[model samples]
Target: MLKVHEIFSSIQGESSHAGWPCSFLRLSGCNLACSWCDTLHAGDSFAGMSVADAAAALAALGLPLVEITGGEPLLAPETPHLVTTLADAGCTVLVETNGSLDISRLDPRAVAVMDVKCPGSGMEGRNDYANLDRLRPRDEVKFVLVDRADYDFAREIAARVWTRQMVHFSPVPGRLDAAELAAWMVADRVRARLSLQLHKYIWSPDARGV
Candidate 1:
């Protein structure tokens, strides 16, 4: 059984896939609590269900792309099984996880968007730096920048990490302005793509499920 928080259809909001319509499977629980996290709702008690049941619910959505996000999806021991089951059901599974978890155990077919916490996030030290070697080109590494310090830190990591093609940077939802972050990227000549929460601009910033 998987501890699922919610299963709903929404656009991919925070990665290169942003603005694309996708179904989201938000699981419950997390191993780390970052200061700027917006999905506190996902941290509550989860409703358990079998992998088959989860896949069936996803099949009913009829969407090709499915994101397995969470308070931290990798914390769930059943995550790899869930990813495989969803893939078997013809869903393109994407798992969004904080970089602290061991993703080598996850399904290789699933696209992983691993968040590498920056200094401003307070949980920066918890990042599993070795995960960089484990990421495939299909996977993405995301940095949620809160300020200049975070931006500089992310830039430094992006330079050292061999996965430059998979790098992404996005401002914290309400902390930094998008234009400012974009300009910084240009000035620094950062090799990462800049992203914004497209769903927030489309709907209310706080709206649940697109």
Candidate 2:
């Protein structure tokens, strides 16, 4: 069994799959605390359930996609097994993780939306640089910008380290404005696609389980 916060259905709010209807299996616990973390409660264990139970909950939703997010999903030792179980249930799994963890052990079939923390996050030094080498073209890398400095930092990183096809640049909700980030991306000619937390805008900003 895995520590779990909640399981619900919602639209993909970040990464390349944004706007797609998906079943969310939010696992509990994280190794880092970013300043802009919206799901602080997710890291605090509210319940526990097995992978099969999680898959069954998602199957009941009848969604084609299942997003396993956190408080860093990698904190769960059984994450890879959960991904396989979800896939076997015919759900396209997407794992959203902080880049600090080693995703090398995860199933390559799952779409990884790894978050690369910026200076504003205070945990930027914790980013696992080696994860970049494990990325496939189908996978995505996300950088959350809290200010212009974060944007510049992300741009530099993208130019030097990341050359993935599906790179995403997202402004920290309520910190940096999306329009400003989009303008910066255009002016700098950055290669990453701009990502907006669409669900936040669609629903209450404080809403849980999407």
Candidate 3:
């Protein structure tokens, strides 16, 4: 069984798949506590459901795009199974992971959008660098920045990976100005795409179920 936080249809808010109509299955719990975490409430509550049931419900959403996200979905033992099940059902599955866990075990049909936490998150040490080798051509790397220090850190990583796959640099809205980050990227010619949380702009940042 999996402890699921919510399953709802919403526009893909981040990553290369942003703006697509997608269904989200947010699992509960996380191993890392990033300082700027927006979904702390996910760990505070959850409802247990079997993997089959979870996949079934998501398929019923009828959206071709489905994402298995979380308070860190990779933390759940059932996540890989849930992802594979959905992929088998012909859904273009995207798994959003926090870069602390092993991602190679997931089904090849599913794409992974792995977040390489920046120093501002205070969880950089939790990163498993080995996961970098596991990223597929279709996979994506994400860095959520809050300060210049975070931006510098992400810049180094993006230089190495951006040429091989998709890399996104997103600023923590209140802490770092997007325009400022954009200017820095322009000056440095950073090899990454500036990602804004599109859902936050479409609705309240705190709103759930999109």
Candidate 4:
């Protein structure tokens, strides 16, 4: 059983899949505490459900895409089975993970959206850089920037470690301006794409369940 927080259908908020209709299974608990984390409530309060039950719930939504996000879904031992179950149910699965944990064990059919923690997030040291080598061509690496330093850090990583996979640079809402982040991306000529949380823009920033 997984510690299930909330399951809902919403627009793909961030990633190469952004703007698509997606069902989200927000699992509970996180090992790292990022300063800018917007889903803190997801970590604690949750209902325990088996992988089959979770898959059935998402299948009922009839969305073709599903994102298994967390408070760090990787923190759960059954996550791999949950992901596999979802994939077997014919959902194009996406798993958003903090890069602190090894992602190699996740089902190959699911696209991995891994985050490389920036210094401003206060969890940079926890990043498992080895995850870079494990990223598949369809996988994505993400960095949430809070300031110029964070952008520079992301740039440096992009220069050294970037592969065929898409890299995403996201501005920390309220801390870094999206326009300023775009300018940095242009001036630096980084290969990454700018990732905005489309759900936040479409609805209220604080709104949950899309």
Backbone-clash count (model 2): 0
Candidate models: Cα lDDT each: 0.86, 0.86, 0.92, 0.92
lDDT of 3: 0.92
Clashing pairs counted in every model: 0, 0, 0, 0
Candidate RMSDs in order = 1.3, 1.2, 0.7, 0.8
* Clash pairs detected, candidate 1: none
- Runs of candidate 3 with Cα error greater than 4 angstroms are none
Residue-level lDDT for 68 in candidate 2 = 91
Model 4, position 147: C-alpha lDDT score: 99
TM-score of each: 0.96, 0.96, 0.98, 0.98
- Where is model 4 poorest over a 10-residue stretch in terms of lDDT? 157-166
Candidate 3 residue lDDT tens string, 1-210: 798899999999999899999999998999999999999989858999999999889989999999998898988888888888888889999999999999998999999999998999999999998999999989999999999999999999778788898999999989999999999999998889999999999999999998
TM-score, cand. 3 vs. native: 0.98
